[model samples]
Target chain A: MSTFIQTLHLAWQNTNSLLCVGLDPEPTKFPGALANRSDAIFDFCRKIVDATAPFACAFKPQIAYFAAHRAEDQLEQLIAHIHLKHPALPVILDAKRGDIGSTAEQYAREAFERYRADAVTVNPYMGFDSLEPYLEHKDKGVIVLCRTSNPGGSDLQFLDVGGRPLYQTVAQRAAEKWNTNGQLGLVVGATFPKEIELVRSLVGDMPLLIPGIGAQGGDVEATVRAGRTAAGTGMLINSSRAIIYAGNGDDYADAAALAAQKTRDGINAYR
Target chain B: MSTFIQTLHLAWQNTNSLLCVGLDPEPTKFPGALANRSDAIFDFCRKIVDATAPFACAFKPQIAYFAAHRAEDQLEQLIAHIHLKHPALPVILDAKRGDIGSTAEQYAREAFERYRADAVTVNPYMGFDSLEPYLEHKDKGVIVLCRTSNPGGSDLQFLDVGGRPLYQTVAQRAAEKWNTNGQLGLVVGATFPKEIELVRSLVGDMPLLIPGIGAQGGDVEATVRAGRTAAGTGMLINSSRAIIYAGNGDDYADAAALAAQKTRDGINAYR
Candidate 1:
């Protein structure tokens, strides 16, 4: 009967880990032994999930990677596998979906109903009503894109709005107006430590899903220092490419586990 | 071979219709005769497409209505059907996708490689890099969301960036920098005539996809007047529910054709 946030926090405490491993398996990067397999992406991700489950707080699977290969049903199976095997571990579907009303409802169903993701990432471009349908599902988490972890993050996000950056405005609104259901979280890139600190102050206890840590060249110490709340429990630092492809050998799963353990310890060192 | 814009202009000239029919078929709202059939959505949209082909410059299929039923294969079939029957008419998949870098490439593949949509709508919240991958495919159209047609369009879109609204800034940037591939368009809601006029002036010759007519209460005259360029060929006025559900009986396809023709003529009167 625990809420989504409560469940996430419980698992966070249980694992004592803030690391959320991203399950992105590029077929070309798969181990040579798995190249001939029909369901290579699924098999690759399942191994990553199994290897990193004990050391991770959450799992995130980017939908585009699966949908690109017409493997959406495999994504469904992956989510089901995680829930059945590691019920405490939440799966955040990295689908930055945004649309108006009924269209938003279908995206909601795609994330929560079809894949049963405990949380889903969403884009906030179309404003409140685009996300209002997802917010209605109180038991699920809706992580709104605030300041993305990309090279072009400054293009539109830095636009001045009322003497504050646009990301701050979005964070303020998510804290004050959009979290009536308490199922809201904000995404702030780990590369922008100062912005992450500012959002941390504005959003109080609402969790921030921090990307851009490993392959994206975000400093782990700065991320952990700036992103944590007063209670030291508000950030889910994600590392995908670095952990998943830590070693492209037969012991890839073991290498991923080692990388996850190192990342977990690294975050805890700063915390 | 014509470019995406050139193909769109060719179709616009051939039909003399700026009208884009949205093939969004909801099962519960389907005409009773076809509701019991398993492939009802594809069947419904095929008939609508067949009936309205003569009056439409483009066909838009909303992804939500298709994904809601786990009938993505049906959507694929519908797109294939449109390509086979009416190769001249472009199919714009109304999947408002936005993500960052590598993930964005996968989404681009989902729209272009998987679904074979000539154009795909994208949200611009993640800034330039999120839409950059889609822009890489020179032959495909990347329609960014601007001033949307929803009730909450003003929530974040109206924020003052410098002296102008945020949507204006977005339009300015998209016009100046984001059209590098020559396959760029903007989505401006028909409900806001003044905004449409402002965006048209800002973006110059870039086409605008105008949603929010008919069921959304947008006036056809104002949309045609404000959304057109000097050449009177820069607008694609879309009507979904009002035209598609014009009847609930066996004659629904004929009724849809009539509604589409009326809408087309109404837009032409102002053009």
Candidate 2:
């Protein structure tokens, strides 16, 4: 199998898309049959995946969203379906997991083995050892949270560390010291395109997972302009609620597909 | 219903035990019948909890250990068992989960509603919003990771932010601003007694969940002296593998109980 980043590059070329469809399934937000709690998270995500697969470069399913509803089994099925049908598209398990050494190993297994994700998002607060276990997975991608999309992200991330922001230090570390496997990426929020640009300067050509674009009101042009590499690639622009819940009706999948296309085109215009 | 801190205080008083028995089950490390795969995580942890209950002020089940083995159902069952048998002892689910606002809500549901954990450990990397959801749980404890037990914790926790270390800054925030609910606590690793002392001084009698003491080689006396409040309470000294896996034979539960009692008495001496 090609490496996770390689597979992502392949998807970018084949589909000509940088859109990473975030599958954050809220049971209450589902339309029609999927909402009644019978046909569940798996069904809704499967439908959205099938509808938007061609237009998306990656799929990031936030683990909390699955684990909250105890829909992990369904999440497993959803990833299995994605691998079977949309093999080229990488699935990033957005589980910002951080812990000590041995515990970190289990979290890595949960992401790579239990769920069989191509990539996983991790929190950098615990430092290198917390991330070392995840990086040991040869072909999988380990994306570190640098500048998060939330407004409260600044609460700690912007603390000055040696005249540079903490997020910049994280980006520098992830780019320089932590990318031992060469299968690493950094999460720079779409809302903070300037920080994204700063991270881009720090980590040359490393993949950036950009969240907070569509529903969170991040500027698409600024995100693309700030994060994209020389090849006009290297960014996964994520839109979750905006795309997946575009319509609260029976044609939700169709609406999701349209939204995914619009998002993909919007990023491409800036590229 | 008593608040999470009140319940923890009650447990400490009733048991006269500062020890928190951490049930981190690695199936491979199981002894005899439990190791054969016929008996599962719940069975292993249930036995350990039953044996160590008298000596432990609380029980902390690390989520990664269960989720790694596709044992979420067992985790749910185990927490239910803890509530059923040891109603007085609080169960702190050590998940170390962190995310943005909306997703954090789902995680809060998982910890408080699905698993019914009395308290949960959270990573503070994403800042206040990531924690707001967990804080919303009326009587459940929200324990933020300050200075972790792992050596790698120094990677970011010790970064200089305005002449003070990052972890002290975290402790200040958790105590001053984030404890909107009376149920807030901080995870100050037993390994860092100096930092723990600093944290205690910052957040006056707030409960500090102290991990890394037993298997990780943290000094019990130092941990107890540094973390305890004026009333000789306000700490949950967690020992996971050191207590739970004290034996490799069928009498593992008996050995775990022995270890738990010894650990409890050791802390009581310091108090």
Give the number of the best model, judged by DockQ. 2
- Cα lDDT tens digits, model 1, B139-179, are 99989999999988888899999988999999998999888
lDDT tens readout by residue for model 1, A179-269: 8888999999998999999999899989999999999999999999998877677888999999999989989999999999999999999
- Candidate 2 collision pairs: none
TM-score of each: 0.98, 0.98
Point out where model 2 deviates above 4 Å: B37-39
| lDDT tens readout by residue for model 2, B134-175 | 888888999999999888899999999999999999999988
lDDT score for residue B160 of model 2: 95
DockQ score of the complex predicted as candidate 2: 0.91
Cα error, candidate 1, residue B104 (Å)? 0.7
Q: What is the interface RMSD of each candidate, in Å?
A: 0.9, 0.7
Model 2's number of clashes is: 0
Q: Give lDDT: candidate 1, residue A35.
A: 95
